[model samples]
Target: MTKHIARVLAAVLLSIWAYGAHAGDVIRSFNADILVREDGVLDVTETIKVNADGTDIQHGIYRDFPQYVTTPDGTRYKVSFEILSVTRNGEDEPWEATDTDLGTKIRIGDQFQLVSTGNHTYQIRYLTDRQIIFGDASDRLRWNVTGDEWSFPILSASAHVILSSGAQPFEPIAFTGSRGRKLADAVATVSGRGATFETTHALDPFEGLTIMVQFPKGAVAPPTTAQLSDWWWRDNLGWVVLIYGFAAVFAYMMFTWLWFGRDPKAGTIVPRWDLPMGISPALMSYIFDGMNRPGFTGDL
Candidate 1:
């Protein structure tokens, strides 16, 4: 009876040790790329590097997003999510996804064992609608990273956001928010039309990670015909006024010249040269006699 009790106690202790060892899985790194389009759609691609402790049999991944978001103007937009694809180590992997009240629950385990000594990379791609809200004055996006919601701790995490066509020349403002503690060490950069945010230190569970970006109004709205015409007239009004003023001045000058500014003797011909001041009668007679010779006498 003593030996049996000792054996049972040993087995219970070993099971507890095994369970503790299996719970040691940790995330090495996480990266997310979010693309925002003009049609109010968001395409997200996530890459996660996880290190398993070689004890757990499988791994499960979950992602969540708000079902609806309300803007400052009391406008509400419905949010929807669709999973695109899932891959592990560059190969496609099968996953089971279910919609829950909180968000989405994804399970990848049975067929492909995730228990390994080294690191394994998993890439998840998905699409969401109405993630960006277009307001009358500005467009805004509020995105949350799955790093803080994961089961294990994340060592490093980064997110890159790209605005698709139609949102050019608009400045973007981005900032980060944490759930529990203040993460003052988060770094964010805005270049051209894209923004990038990164965190170097570990992210504890439930310490929410979120990014907010705001774009100026009219960035995604194309100009209507009336708007284009109004802009054209507004921009070229100065040139048009100057041209009409010049035309009026030229017409006035031409009218004056034709009506009251002409020369009085303009139609009459004038002699090219005047005769000599004085000449003797004999010299004048000789000059006239010489001019009245040969070819000069034909007209007479």
Candidate 2:
């Protein structure tokens, strides 16, 4: 039993040594900034400094989506990633992109030649729409930093996330290690109409740095005064004009009828009385005829 145990221990130590020896590059610093837009788009920028040991000619950086991500409401969404831009040493370098079964691989070098031995800086920008999940009560954003599958050990790592301007205020939560074995604190600040969360630490291979933030529902921007006025005219201006036009026409008809539409005889006053006893029939007839013929042009 003692002989078997010794052999097993030696083998384990050798394997550990071999694994450590194969670590090609070391990360000096890794910083990431994530901006959450109002339209559910997440804009991400990562700055990385790598200390290449001069072993390989070219370096590869890759981004892959998680198989599944669960929201606070137990709903799951398939993650997707899109790389926007990549730069090396503050200058645009030649890179080859390839789509593989695993994910996208971006190799950076000089004319497909080998990379030099030294500290190199790289910046990568990407877009992802699956990070922020909308809910009935609030929207939630889940981010995984170390989970991106880096092959090197990171000496220092930092991340900052800026929420949308219309998002409701809430505290953010962060976790570290496998299965979230440790909880980490983050600094939160409110600037202008949005909020930001920042944290910094170091990470080993396979260790995860994850964050989850909850914001209020309907975090979209409110309508501005100018926008409201434009919308009103665009949607309801015709109705308003039609109503006012109908009112003016009605007023004109009323005025015309009151001024010129009445009957001419309506203003005449006729006197009715009992004739005096001894009045001649001819005289009465003459008086009635004259009254009726006042406006009539005929032989008198």
lDDT of 1 at 45: 96
Candidate 2 structure quality by residue, lDDT tens digits, 59-175: 545444453555579954444467788888888766666765544566655554566777889888888654565667787776776464665566666667776565554666666
Candidate 2 residue spans exceeding 4 A from truth: 1-24, 55-60, 63-77, 97-103, 166-169, 179-201, 220-300
Score candidate 2 by TM-score against the native: 0.55
Instruction: Give the best candidate by lDDT.
Output: 1
lDDT of 1 by residue, 1-300 (tens): 999999999999988975464356766677889888665568999998887765442554545545555567995444567888988788887788776655566776445544456678889998876566566778877677653456556666778888786453233333333443455545777777777777755665555456667777655554458755764565467789999999999999999998999877766787695557797666666787867754332553
The per-residue C-alpha lDDT of model 1 at residue 50 equals 81
lDDT of 2 at 250: 97
Question: Which segments of candidate 1 are over 4 A away from where they belong?
Answer: 1-23, 54-57, 65-77, 111-114, 166-182, 221-300
